[model samples]
Target: PPDVEQLGRATWTFLHTAAAYYPERPTPNQRANMLNLLHSLPTLYPCSHCASHLGDNLKEHPPDVSGKAALSHWLCQRHNDVNERLGKERFDCTKTDERWKDGPSD
Candidate 1:
């Protein structure tokens, strides 16, 4: 079984990548599905402590699924919140596409 940190990193990678590929203007169904996925995390996530924290955060700042940019920024902010709690450096939300979609410019 993977540790909490490993699980978290993998989860974030999946989320960011998904957000990167998300349609610029998704259909109502796509938005609803995205909301469902985000809402399910607190209940389905393996790490109880992490899930609780995420649930609390979600209550304070719900997911923004209006569009690809909105969702990507929302997820980046959420990830930054976790990074702050863990004393990790915050990722630059501006570079989200580069990080998650296009390869970083060398």
Candidate 2:
């Protein structure tokens, strides 16, 4: 079984990558589906404490399902908030595409 930290990292990676590839102008159905996925996480995530915190954050900020860029930025901001709470270094949101979609320049 994965630890809480491992689970968290994996979950974030999946979400960010998905957002990175989401359509720039998604259909109404697509947007609704994405919103459902995001909203369900707080209830579905395994870690109780993490789920509670995520639920609170979602209530405060909600998910930005306007488009790919908006969703990516929203997720990045939420990730950074979690990183701050954990005393971890926050990622640079500007480079989200590079980090998630494009390979880093060598």
RMSD of each: 1.9, 1.9
lDDT tens per residue, model 1, 1-106: 4599889888998999999999999999999999999999999999998999999999999999999999999999999999999999999999999899998622
lDDT of 2 by residue, 1-106 (tens): 4499889878988999999999999999999999999999989999989999999999999899999999999999999999999999999999999999896523
Local distance difference test, candidate 1: 0.94
Tell me the spans in candidate 2 whose CA falls farther than 4 Å from its real position.
104-106
Candidate 1 weakest ten by summed lDDT: 97-106
Best by lDDT: 1
